[model samples]
Target: GSFAVSSFVSTIGKSAFSLPFEDGSGAALAADAGSLAGYVYLNAGGTLVRQPGPVVGAELSWNGLRLTVTASLPAEAGISGYTGKPTCVSLSGPVAAGGSEYDVTSVMDGAFRSCKTLASASLPGVEEIGKESFYGCSKLVSVSIPDAKSVGVKAFARCSHLSELDMGGHLRTVSAYAFFGCSALASFDGGGSLKTVGSYAFSGCSSLRDVSLGPALATIGAKAFASCPIESVDLSPVLKTVKDQAFAGLEFRDSGGSVLAHTAAALRGHAFSGSGGVLVAEQ
Candidate 1:
């Protein structure tokens, strides 16, 4: 006779017993079970039950925050028969582990790099994104991180299919190569409090046409908007510096809708060296 098993149970009962191991290497009796220890036994209702085991790769903070250090799946939730890659991931709110609730705060560098199947991500509470966190995820299309303040270098570089990015109102910095080579990105609206755009941050985004620099923006780094097809830019008067080729190879129109004839004030170092026209400084 065969016994039916229920879903994963968080708490073990008094009658639970550890499942037998097949060898000294610590392999469990179940064929698909990983190296994590588990208990399998009959409950009061005569139904077999399994409990959730420990996760292998992650960092727990002293204050109840968790950070994903590696991209590997947990041992208890191993992908034994599923062959398709994960398409969507939601890492928002609190997660329960070891009888304690933890808020997932950040993703370590290169945590999800090259995950080609990842398409969308929602990180509402994450404050910082490490370098190369989602680099080379070709199928990625949308991302929503309303509370994120800083985006590290190469964090989302080479995400070819990424089109929508909601960086929220508190973002302050975009590091170099953050969204480089994302050919499908069409527009960017840097919400309030954005202060700096690092060199080459959005370089090589071929389809980028519209950009809204927030009021607090003060710097535009070298080649930051190079190779894009933008037609005009309404820069903030508080903007203090424009590095070399920052707006290279683009055309600009003035308030009257005519091509600008001369370079604008506060622009230096070939800021518009190769463009058809230069922007007019905001009065």
Candidate 2:
């Protein structure tokens, strides 16, 4: 069924109503607290195509009183298919520390693409972080997605300037280039269900220090942690596979107890092409 958002675009609250999209008329629909969003996807020519579910946290409240997400998303809770301007998104006002959630109707995937100056965001209990979720966010200094689970490929690729990431214990997986060029990230606290780390997950993270792999993760795909400033490879017992070039340009040694040079000799591809560091065997 098609979704509809009413004409009340001043306040961001919870309520549900169906608006008419035919003919030529706009009406205000009042919603309640349990429900918190209203949107109908539009095509390139600005025609309604899909009905977006309840929009939570920040809703694009501009554009002649209408916004559209017509990117053909993956149709999952935390996944994304968002596009266009970064108008006004809602904040949870004031809750407790680690208490408030922005998962009301998570559509963060490609939601804020190339919105480099997005200095504010609030999403929690999100499941899958779609590719390039925050690509090219050059001015993002802080972010708070404490309950995210699976992060899709290039989720934060080329976010050249970001700091203070707070991924809580509930996070699970991370796709390629999850933080490719986020040069300002300092530390990360792995979540619970994260099992896979894809290629370039943290490549070129110039300011990153260290990331403790999740206890349940079993695989580290190629170039998963390629270029960073980390000091060591702190592996978890659940790790099983470290793909070729997974940590190419870093000081990370595999579970094989061999130095990176020696390990790369046995792998399927180069593991230290442009990286700078020493690889000592785990004694």
Best candidate according to lDDT: 1
lDDT by residue (tens digit), candidate 1, 26-108 = 33344233421333333323333434323445443322223432222221211111124768767546665555444555655
Q: Clash totals for all models, in order? A: 0, 17
Candidate 2 per-residue lDDT over residues 1-283, each given as its tens digit: 4444342433644332243232123232234422223445443243334343333333333221122222122211232433354433433422111222222334356756787446756566454466777777777777777767777777778877678787777777888788888888866667666677887788778776656665677777787666666654455565667787776665534446454442323332222222246543344
Supply candidate 2's per-residue lDDT for 146: 72
- Scored against the true structure, residue 166 in model 1 reaches a CA lDDT of 93
Provide the RMSD of all predictions against the true structure, rounded to 1 decimal. 12.9, 11.8
List runs of model 2 lying over 4 Å from the truth. 1-90, 93-105, 251-276, 279-283
* Model 1 weakest lDDT span, ten residues long: 73-82
Q: If candidate 2 were superposed on the true structure by all CA atoms, what would the RMSD be?
A: 11.8
Off by over 4 Å in 1: 1-84, 253-283
